[model samples]
Target: MNKVQSDFLSLLENHRSIRHFLDKKIPDFDIRRIITAAQSVSTSSNGQAFSIINVTDQEMKKKLANYAGSQKQVEDCSNFLVFCADLFRLEQISQRLNVEMKKVLDSTEMFLIATIDATLVAQNTVVAAESLGYGIVYTGGIRNNPEKVSELLNLPYRTFPVFGICIGYPDPNRIPEKKPRLPLGAVFYQNEYPNFDEVYPYINKYDETMKEYYRNRSESKREDTWSKTITDKRKIPRRMNMKSFLEEQGYPLK
Candidate 1:
């Protein structure tokens, strides 16, 4: 591979979700450039049904930090960008052109389109920001109180806050060690999905690797297996109100 390709892969491999940030500010030009890079990502059918809210105000950040389950990173980061799945823009455009879009906009397909579009753009933004020497973390906790977040940001109909990205200079002293991922074999399948029996070995191997990773990490060191950790985290029914919340937000997802 060429030097450029190798360097890019290295960057991706070295990524760590930075929660501790320095008290610094990102310049307007860099923010714009990051968005530009993010926008270059492909969207669903060119609908581009998403929007980003860059929150920099101190008071607003505090409220957002609370809404995001008291995640201090939401307030500490120089820029907390809320990536929204937005059909509101399309709705407005269709209305201006005397076209009907309400029925289609409320479809499950359109909801998927908007959600996928926002997620694609957010991933690109992460890559771009990291390339520029900034640290970043995705704050999915924003969805814990999606209604409050939408209200605070003044989000309109047919738009919902999907997730957020915290971008800023990393606190060098507190930067967490990179965590290991599942074995590729456990995730990748060829023509057909592999049988559970075949995948179990891969999972077992990964569990051992992760157990070591957890025990040796710089902070929050613990003795735990991947399966136990995942079960403990996911077995709980969290965010059960998201369906009703989305319906109220004009995404009935019919």
Candidate 2:
């Protein structure tokens, strides 16, 4: 491989979500650039149906942290951004332009499009933030109680808070070590898809690698593997009431 390819691959390989950060604020210019990177990400049909809210109010952060399962990072980070799937913006534009928003707004396809757009843009922001020496952690617990979160953010009917991201300069002392991932054999496929037998072994091997990772973490070490962790996670129905929440937000999922 060429030097450039190797260096870029190394950056991709070393990614770890930063939960603990120094109490330093990111500069406004850098924040703008990071958000620009997010905006630069391609969207479905160029709809750009997503919006971000940067929560600067400390009281609001504290309230959001409590709402998001008490994740202290939400309150402690230099910047906290809520990425929302926003059809309301487009709805207003359609109304101004004399277009029929009803044709798109109330469908499952619109929900999927907004969700994909929001997630992709946020992921782009993460890479850009890391490139500029900032640390970040994405919190999906923002969905724990969506109605209250939506109300707190003053979201319109056609909007839903998908996730929250905390950004800041990394605290050198609190940097987390990178964990292992599943092998290519488990994830990548050529022309045809491999059946379970070919992929199952890789998952087992990844579990072994994750066992070491969990055991060696600087804080909150555990005696579990990737498989066990996933199993335990699945035992509980995560986001069981999200349907009702989404319905409340004007997405009956029809």
Candidate with maximal TM-score: 1
Report per-prediction Cα RMSD to one decimal. 0.7, 1.3
- Over 1-254, each residue of candidate 2 has an lDDT whose tens digit, in order, gives 99989977887777898988888888989999899977989999999999999987889999999999999999899899999999999989999999987867889999999999999999999988987889989999999988889999999998999999999988889988887789999999899899989999999999999999999989889999898999898898888899998988977777
Best by lDDT: 1
Whole-model lDDT, model 1: 0.95
The residue-by-residue lDDT of candidate 1 on 1-254, one tens digit each, is 99999999999999999999999999989999999988999997898999999999989999999998999999999999999999999999999999988889999999999999999999999999999999999999999999999999999989999999999999999988888888889999989998899999999999999999999988888999999999999999999999999999999989
Cα error of candidate 2 at position 112, Å: 0.7
Worst 10 residues of 1 by lDDT: 175-184
Candidate 1 lDDT at 78 equals 98
Q: Give residue 251's error in model 1 in angstroms.
A: 0.6
Model 1: colliding residue pairs: none
The collision pairs in model 2 are: none
Worst 10 residues of 2 by lDDT: 7-16
Q: What TM value does model 2 have? A: 0.96
